[model samples]
Target: MTDLRDVTLRDGLQLTGKPLPTARKVAVVRELLDAGVPSVEIGSMARPDLVPPLADTLDLIRALDPDELARCWVWVATPRHVERAAEAGAVNFQYCLSASDAHNRANIGRSTEDSLAAMPRAVAAASAAGGRIQLCIATSFTCPFEGAVPEERVLAIARDPRAEGARDIVLCDTLGQAVPTQVTSLVARVAAEMPPRRIVYHGHDTWGLGVANTLAALAAGASEVDGALGGLGGCPFAPGASGNASTEDLLFALRPSWLTPSSFARIVRLSGALLDELGEPNRSRAAQGARTSATAFPWALGAEVSCR
Candidate 1:
């Protein structure tokens, strides 16, 4: 019953071998919206020189219509990033920063405190553009350079006065090292103690606990969760990080009200085609299981779904 924000285009394609064309990205977004996904992280405002694959984010933004843009999120770091993306018609901005100083510096080129200090301006920019903003805390669980991030560090960012106007707060396991217990504790604390904004869980599958941690976060009060098709994503800045939680797997497990059997089949086929086009392996067990010959299983894809 929870909302799944598919990050297939933004995070999923980050580590891919080739960049997807703007027309293809537009088609995928339309298909995803048609298939019932509530939100999609379509792209980022990060420097093109740093991540060449996502360099076309602004073009993709221009391709989507306003209604489509409303359901899509564009990742940003500073106020100017938000402003630029807003000019490109991005309505939802996910202003991101890591919980640790090292990872924050590595990922966004600034300290965690500096990122927090800029949130008020980022929020204002989103408001000025007549859109909404979400505060996204990366490295919420562990940082590649500094190791474990204390729970208090994440809480402080969430409770910061400058982060006032964000509509939601996303806690990210950038390195995928957080177990279910860690996810549960932090998510519960944020829900019970922090500002009354919605909690979002963004996890990676580095240690094979992405789904478990996601379930834990949901149980702890995360109404929305992020995942990528075929589990394709890794922080370019965070060494040792791997793919994201699988969107196909989450759809099967969560079974939100809008998701029908046909819709699930469509999502599976779409993910399969995209992964095949990129020549990437499918890391989603649920996605693999869905393609089984056993048609009797309710979760199994019927003969109609095939990317090959």
Candidate 2:
């Protein structure tokens, strides 16, 4: 089974009007964990002034139990970011950079080469903090500024000597612009050519192909994928990007062992409440479908069993 890392509390809150309180964020993390999501990205180390919703990432990190934190990820764009977050009790780090220099500069205030050069240091910081790190390549498919990032540009970063110690390599569809064919081809190439590391696909639904591309990547040997609870999120830096792939939709399609009708109901309920708090519409088709009056459907949240 492909491991689905739910990014609701982190990426899902990015574009929302109000950030959830630290207590609420902690509760959401536990709810997802209780529901058996194997992994989650709870927050990022982006400049709080720039990304206000992510301001309390450190507080959430400190509040979580170490065991709970182990299965969670926090985003970082530099060695210093990783170091600071590690000190704040974050255990797993996703060191992120963009494939294109222009996007990297726009997102993280640095060149692509500068970010690549910082990888080894970030890896060392995670290791020294007794945690693991993953290399997350944003704009792996396309750049908002540059447009249509080359496949080789991404492959080169994956193959970079500095990226060696990363346990996983995540290819991000930052702009949600990649088609299934593009996702499949790149994932296949990386799986075949790159050294053995867990291949992860992080996609967006801007073009409505998020689920399609995720399945394609999984078929091409991606071991993990990312999604968000209410399909909330978009890059402030990358225009035209929508939410990450919906966790509700992915669970419905993948049908993981943890997703019983009852557990699914709980997930939908929690996401509903959380989305309501954020004042963001639930963009998840599956979540909306479950709440519909189609109670005859086995997958409906309102239907545990059929009366007929």
Candidate 3:
């Protein structure tokens, strides 16, 4: 089965300027797990001062009952963040570092080289703390300031982290500039460089090719994928970009290949309900279908899964 990780809490809300309340966040997590998502990227470790929207991140973590998502896994970033997450009972961790020089400076106030230099130390810290590390190579695709990132640069980043004992590595399509051919080719290259099980695709939907790129990566042998709940994320640091691939849309599109329609549709309904409660309009294809026709309420079963 394909592994799916939802990123609505972390990436989804970064641009909305509204922090989801702890209760609402917890409810969404429970709903996602019930919908059968194996994992969720709930928040980030960036300074709460910089992202007041996620200021309650630590508090949310502190109050999270392990049993609420017993079947699901949640992840966060940074060594200090991981420590705090551990205190709050998070079972998984995602350590993000930028690969694009321009984005690194803009997002983390560090250069690519500086970020790479810190990887070994970050990896060591997380490992020492006894949590699994999923290193996120952000801006693996084209960058806004510096377009068309070289494949070799991304490969080097992935290889270095893997060499440092990172068990999981995600290639982030930060600006959603990646095409299917690029995604497939990159996945093949990364797979050849590292263990196949360790690679994942984290795509954005800016150009409306999120699902297409995801299929390309999967077709090229990627076992895991990352997306948000309802097409709900945009880079707060990266200017004029769009959201991550919607969890509901991604699942609905991938149903035939990965999950049964009944399973995918259930996830859509739960995700839609949470989105409604959050005061955000649904951007999911399944949700749109439901609005248009009751027959499409369970759209995943018959919806076209073709890559655009």
Candidate 4:
């Protein structure tokens, strides 16, 4: 079965200039869980100055109902962040490294080599702290500053994490420039080395191929995919990058047998509410089309929305 992890609260809200109240973040997460989303990246343990919206990451996690929190997976950037989150009861942690040196430097003020060297430490820390870890290879396809990244470069980085006991590795289309062909080719090559279930695809929708590329990856044997609700996420540090594949849109495209029509509608309504709350234009094509075709979206009609 294809597993979808909603990243709206963590990656989605990071770049938005406005900060979402902790209550709203908790409410959205609860809605997503109720809608049958298996995993949710509720917040990141990053510095407040770097991303103001996630400043209250710990508080947000604390506010979640224990039952819901038990069902959630959280993301963090470094071993230090992982340690903190694990102490606060986070069972899962995600750390990222860019395949392109230039993008790495621009993103974390560090070189790709330095980041790769630190993987073992990060994984070790997370594991020792009783947290399951997933490693993300950012700019796995193309980089905004460095252009196209070689598949070998990404594969080599993947080796480090895998060796450090990271069974799940997410290949990120940091700039959203990857085509389906590239996704299938690279994922196939990676699956040849690792188990197919160990691979995940994280895509953005800048070129409108997010879902297409994701489908290609799944066809190529990726076991999981990552998306944001309302398509609300972009890398503030990665220039030219856009929001991720919309959760509602992906569900609409895949029409998974497990998701009922009522559940689908509830997810779409929650996505619409999130779009309205962010005061941002609907980045989700599915949401926009639904609003246009039906008069049911009172929030979309009542408000003037602008894109980020």
TM-score of each: 0.96, 0.95, 0.88, 0.91
TM-score of candidate 2 against the unseen true structure: 0.95
- Models sorted by lDDT, best on top: 1, 2, 4, 3
Q: Give residue 52's lDDT in candidate 4 (0 to 100).
A: 90
Q: lDDT of all the models against the reference? A: 0.91, 0.89, 0.74, 0.80
* Lowest summed lDDT window (length 10), candidate 4: 299-308
Tens digit per residue, CA lDDT, model 1, 134-232: 999999999999999999999998998999899999999999999999999999999998647999999999999989999999999999999999899
After superposing candidate 1 on the true structure, give the runs of residues whose Cα lies further than 4 Å from its correct spot. 297-308
List, residue by residue over 1-308, the lDDT tens digit for candidate 2: 77999998777888777868999999999999998889899999999998999999999999999999999999998888889999999989999999989989988999999999999999999999999999999999998889888899999999999999899999999888899999999999999987579999998999898899998999999999999987888888887888999999988877776667777777888988988888888999988888884564464533353321
Give per-residue CA lDDT, model 4, range 82-129, as digits (tens): 778777777777787789999888777788788677777778887887
Cα-based lDDT at residue 43, candidate 4: 86
Q: What is the lDDT of residue 39 in candidate 4?
A: 82
Tens digits of per-residue lDDT for model 3, 1-308: 68888888888877775457887877777767666677777776677777766667666665666764333334443456666766666656677777779888888777877766766666666667666677778889888788889999898888774336567778889999899999999989988877644788999989998889998998898888988877878887887678888887777666635455666666667767767766776677655664567675544365563442
